[model samples]
Target: MNSPDIKPPGAEPAVKTHDNRRRWWTLLAVSAAQLLVVLDGTIVNIALPSAQTALGMSDASRQWAITAYALALGGLLLIGGRVSSALGHRRTFIIGLVGFAASSALGGAAVNPGMLFGARALQGVFAAALAPAGLSLLTTTFTEPRERGRAFSVFAAVGAAGSALGLVAGGLLTEYTSWRWCLYINVPIALFAVGGTALVPADRPIRGGGRLDVAGALLSAAGFGAVVYAFNEAEPLGWGSPKVLALLVGGVLLLAAFAAVEVRAPSPLLPMRVLSHRARAGALVSITLMFVAMFGFYLFMSYYTQTVLGYSPVQAGLTLIINALAALLGSTLIAGRLHGRVPPAMLILPGLIAAAAGMLILTRLTPQTTDVLPLYLVPALVLTGLGLGCVLPPTAGLATSDVHPYDIGAASAAYNASQQLGAALGTALLNTIATSAAASHLASARHATPTGASVHGYTTALTVGFGILLAAACVTAPLILKQQRS
Candidate 1:
């Protein structure tokens, strides 16, 4: 005789409701973590000069403050993604938030340069963990089509605005408080976010008890690290240096090995299945290209505002409000409307073209240029923002679209990894191009007038920025548009 059929009460249904509520809270917590991490990259830029004078850093060592974070974050992002999948998003997210906050505190309190740099690198490692986990949490939390689109729009907008907000926040904090506050600010934010994380649901691990692809992780990390190092070296060591050549070759070989290993591994770190769809591939490429152009624009435009136009950090930061506001509008309004109305590929093509046009307009800046009113620079800034806004949301949505639910973490990780690498490469390559152009311009002008040559050099750099933007547009056009008909 069967024991009375066990009803188990209504506990199962209750548990599911509780879990759903927790998942929504988790998305908020994760998004907060992501915003902090992304903002740190640019916030430091505004405070760099102040930090430099206070810390007595040399010109060459200055870039390391930024590069240290990028190198570690970009290099380890894929590993972080895979690790999150293997462990659990909830666990990884918590660990990352705690680690990131601790590092930020350390960096803020540093009395010496070495400590600060080390802290930044540590922050990068945790950021690598936090970013993908945050994204994957969103991907899993919102499974319905409309809810997914809304969720991604909010995520994308936060990400797009993060850099601009960093500039403004950095200026205020640096001027009123200290450069260290920029780092210290993360502590409280992270703490609050961590508390919120407790409310989010934890996802179960992929079946087969996911294994770490040690070889794949190493190969991918080392390869990206090598390539980034090569780009950084190119500016000081020359493009043809033996060390540069060695690094390029080593990076290529390691990446080739990573591809091979991914093909063979039963539980791959980044599976090929995530990239099988044409729309997804197009979206990833478009996102990469958008960052490529936008990062370079930021690098040059910041310099143009401060060094060339003689604006203080606060003034320059304020000017960027135009771009920031435009981006916010584009992400929220334009991006939301275009979601199902037009395919992502079509949206990306025009978005990139507009960004390229903005870059071209900026190339006209000169030493005597004082106002953005007559020169079309304000509109250019707005266009840049609009283009970025259009590209980021849809591209982000498409990148993780069509993947199996179990693979969301890995897919999100891959998307974030590509973005980080793209930004780093874009920064390094564009800086090198601008620096070389500046040197050439200065060399020619030195014979004519020594004092004026510095300004001439800056103009030359901005010109090169224009060319890079154009090239980015050309590269992305085919990739984005070719998939439209298919």
Candidate 2:
């Protein structure tokens, strides 16, 4: 008879096969959750007009629907991450899914602006919890280096394509069906993920998980909330506005205080150890800067296609699908295949340069360039997508790699927060730049048509985006070098 500790002849392979299959299934569930989070950004953006019209929302009030989500998600991300560590990642993830589904249903049935805004805020609250938990799950599940690369690549591709896919989905749903379906759509997704949860391995939660630092949580939430609100206000109030400036400064101060609190607090929400690594810091910086440019890229592209090229909403949305598809290619064929063989800088440097080049090309768009799809948007989108593909997988790995098992959620949350802030700042900053440029062009060129002025403004902002991307590469280089040297 076999010893008590010994397995039967075929047991090991069978167990290995079972484990392998479970890992991929976990990835699928995680990816679906990620897509659900990301797609909401642009999907609701598309549905906003219809939502406003249906609910009889005023212009000023309409902005609140979007701002509520941004503020809640951005502010609560760190707290959410800590909660996951304390409660258990798997449990937090399912709770988030259930809450998100409930909120989506609430939004779908809303008959007033206040109700809609509250539901969207609820969605953001749950998403903040869900996003970090899912990421931690991925990191803990895939430990082998090469397989991690593959898993990250697949995950990054889904994230990279998510916004563009949102645009497409929003357009189709809003056009062909009711805007309510846009909110309704998430229910089925959440349910499917709930089912997929059965296959996910019950990973261990952080040790002594209940010792959360209350002060640190409060500080982080307020600081991040202030900063996000400041940026959101900047789009409407301008950077020089006293209210915006005050909020921005206050946010910075609160964040600094939070850092000090973390130094002394026994169970800090965001531990210093999570960011002590040079490579991880670099990764976070790179992703943040890329998003600062990328969101503006999407903003300008959508307007240029619709307002300038005269494409329908669906047509404008369709143009972005190419970018998503190209990102998929870049993630799978390039980064996934090459991650282990190369230093991250090898992929990262070239990716930034390529994306910058794409931004540069977009700076030359003319009102009459509508027919230049082959020579213009196609190449730009392809390059940007490929570059994003290269950057995301590598940076994602670096951001959370080699951290203490318990801090994984904190690290992942930090990365997500970087992305959220970057997007908020990008939209505000580039939009301000474009709006000012348009006013300047209109003043200088009496012959400029309104449409021409708008396009000119967009191109000018694209140039700023191009410069920002180059700056990002410069920032990455020395950080990577220092990490390498150490």
Candidate 3:
């Protein structure tokens, strides 16, 4: 990002310096927006304890802090895609940046849980716009294969490591200053992104774009929103509780209806063709599964380090840095370089396998494993980081690959929407699994200490995560390989 005049070595002779600068700036701005979304996912999590205490938030309301954002973003993403097409991607991106910054400011200045929740929801609304618009911008700008690969690598690496960076930032802010700074931090980042957007190439308008599909938008939003809220409520309410079941079933029906509407609509909220491509669909599924498993891993690591090891928030966050560093290596070094040459499955499948192996290593955890940093933690972090680093770039690229210019927004939205749903499901489902496992273990082994039971719960949940990762690999592997052969 620095020294705009200085190009990377081996700049193509055909490319002008001004063009190089614009493309790089575009990458920087889009990557920053992506980081904002991913970082916010976990940064606020670290600050939650402090925020809760200061706001007098009841334990009953804490989940809403997470749910409000996920629900809004997941539910509205499809509509956001349509909106991006209606309005220009560049315009939509700037609007999203301004709105997100304002919402972040409101969140920082919140006086009550209600205000905080509202602010979070507003942030999500803007993020739905920001994410798809940014990705589409990147896709349209970096048309060449090698340039696209490198640009995507940086973007993916930021996304892969952003959560850990959030942990680190949240810890430092919460410990050294007020927790409110965590939200306040977004203001400058957003403003910087907005400024950088000036260098971003404008999106050419889609010719003869059809009318907006109101029915599809409403159905998709309400459907996805309900599904996310259902999962969020599942841990406390019990999965089989009538409320959860009703919400889940209703959401599914609504989604089915949305799909049906898309089939007939003059202008669908998400064009069916966006997903009809087997590779793109598989990429979406893989992204969803990767996040579903990754978030749970993050949750347990944070808990185990802070609650069990009695580490400070900063120390806990610092422990995850290895994961981020390894991610950098894998993304830029391995996946980035090889991306243009190899099939996406080559990176994604092995990445999943490596992540599962890391989770398998963690299955050995016990409460008394006091010196886990050198033993259980580091290797697991490195493996998962490298794995995810390898996984994210290709999937992101695939999601937008071969997409029509008009449907790029839809494809991008689908990609990010998959990530949101995956994170929500992963956190809620895995936490529930961990809680239920701990309760069962305690009941079965009367002599087991609570700490031991907690560790057992974490390991059990991770074991499930391990299986999920492997299953995801299996599911997508054939899709990638078979399609390649055909």
In candidate 1, what are the lDDT values of residues 1-486, reduced to their tens digit? Answer: 656765588978998888768866866797688789779989988888888888888888987777788778878988888777767788888899999999999989888788888999999999998888888888778777666666676677778878878988899999999999999999999999999987887677666635778898888889988887776776677777899889889989998899999989877878888876666776777677677667777776676677656778877787777888888778778876667777776666677777777877766665555665447568878988888877787888877877886677778887887777677666666766676666676677545443245445545555665555566556766655676665
Candidate 2: give the clashing pairs.
Answer: none
Note each model's CA RMSD in angstroms. Answer: 3.7, 1.3, 4.6
Query: How does each model score on TM-score?
Result: 0.88, 0.98, 0.95
Candidate lDDT scores, in order, read 0.78, 0.91, 0.91
* Tens digits of lDDT, candidate 2, 1-486: 758999889999999999989998889988999998998888999999999999999988898888888999999999998888878888999999999999999999999999999999999999999999999888988998888989999999999999999999999999999899999999999989988989998976678755678899899989999999999999999999999999999999999999999998987899898887888988999999999999999999888888877898889999999899989988889999998898888888888888999989888887767556889899999999999999999888898888887788899899999999999999899999999999999899979989888989999999999999999999988897678677
Expressed as tens digits, the lDDT of each residue in 231-279 for candidate 3 is 8888788788999999999999999999999999987888899888888
Top TM-score model: 2
Error of 1 at 26 (Å): 4.1
CA shift of 301, model 1, Å: 1.2
Name every residue pair that clashes in candidate 3: none
